[model samples]
Target: MPKRTIVLSLKDQDIEKFLEYITQRLRGSDYSLTYKDGRIYLTIHGRPREIEDLIRSARKAHGDFMKIHKPVAGVRRYPKDWLVERSRGISLSLLIRA
Candidate 1:
C-alpha cells in the first residue's frame, strides 16, 4: 500500500547529513524525497510500521541536532497540505555554531 506523505524538519546542520542517512536507510524501499520551504517531504509506499521505523531512526541519529514535526496518523496529504492543516506554531530555524 502507498503510505501518505510525511513532513519533517531538520536543523540546518543536519540537512545534508540527514538526507544521506535517510536515503540509505530507505534503500530498496519505495519512497520519494524532496525539499522545499526548508522542510523535507517523504512519500513512502509501505506499512505505517516501516515509516515509523524510519522516523525513529532519524530521530535517534539526529536527536541533538535536529527537530522533527510529525502529523497525526490517518491524516493523509502531501507536505504542503499537512503543514496547512496541522498549523502548529512550530517554525524551522537554523543556527550556525562556529
Candidate 2:
C-alpha cells in the first residue's frame, strides 16, 4: 500500500497526551508519528478506511486543536531517512517566527 501523511498543528503541551491516545489506538497497526516545529506528522501505511478511521479518532479526541490548525495544502511522502533529516532541520525558532 502507498503511504499517506497528515499534518496537524497543535500545542506542544498536548503532544504527550495525543501521542498516548494515538499509540494506544494504533496498537496493532502500522503507523509513524513525529513532531516538528509544533506540528504533528502522522503517516499511515494502510488502506483508506484505516486512514479515515485514524483521522476520525483524532478529531474526536482533539477537535478544538484540529479546528484551529491550518488545513494541510498537500501531503507528500518522503523517504523515511529523509523525513528524519527534514523534520530535524526545522528549528523551533524558525517556527516561532512563522
Candidate 3:
C-alpha cells in the first residue's frame, strides 16, 4: 500500500462543497481530511490511480469554488518534521512508499 497527499486552496463558500465531494468518493476508504490555516489537506491510503481519480473528481465537482492544484506524490515520510518548518498555514505535502 502507498500513501498519497493532496492540497487544495478554497474560498469560504467552497469548503462545504469540497468536503461533500470528498465524502462521496472516499466513502468506506482509509482516508483522513482536515482543515487548518486556510487550506484543505487530504491523506489517503490507496493506489496511485485511485488517488488520482479522487483528485480529478474533486476538482471537477468543486472547480467553481476551489482552485485545485496539482497533486504531489513521493515516498512516504512523516509530516511532523515538515509541518514544523511551514508557516501557520496548510499546504499540500505527500509521502508515498512502495
Candidate 4:
C-alpha cells in the first residue's frame, strides 16, 4: 500500500499541548511525529482504517483547539514522498498553499 502523511501547521499555538493531546489520542497507532519548516508532520504507515482513525483524531484536536484558541492551524494530507522531496531541497511552498 502507498504511504500516507498528515501535515499540521500550527501558528501561534501551544506546541506542547497539541503534541500531548495528539499523542494520547493516537496511542497504539503506527505513526511518527516530526517538526520541520514550522510545521508538524505525522507520518502514518498503517492500514486504511488506521489512517482514517488518525484523521478523525486530528479533526477532534483541531476542533478542541478551535474552541479554546482558534489559532492558525491547518491539517492536510500529502503524498508519502512529500517529506522526501522537502528533505532533498525541493520547494513545496506552492504545493503547500494549494
Q: Model 2, range 1-98, lDDT digits (tens) per residue?
A: 96778887778887887777557646787788789999888787878888788776655545533433325565333333333444677864564455
| lDDT for position 55 in model 2 | 72
Give Cα-based local distance difference scores for all models: 0.59, 0.65, 0.60, 0.68
Prediction 4 global C-alpha lDDT = 0.68
TM-scores, in order shown?
0.48, 0.54, 0.51, 0.59
Decide which is better by TM-score, 1 or 4: 4
Identify the leading candidate in terms of TM-score.
4
Leading candidate by lDDT? 4
Ranking by TM-score: 4, 2, 3, 1
Off by over 4 Å in 3: 64-98
TM-score winner, 3 or 4: 4
Clashing residue pairs in candidate 1 (N, C-alpha, C atoms within 3 angstroms): none
Give lDDT: candidate 2, residue 66. 43
lDDT of 4 by residue, 1-98 (tens): 54577788875356777787678767887888888776888887778887887877776765565455543455444443434445566556655554
- Name the weakest run of 10 consecutive residues (lDDT summed) in model 1: 89-98
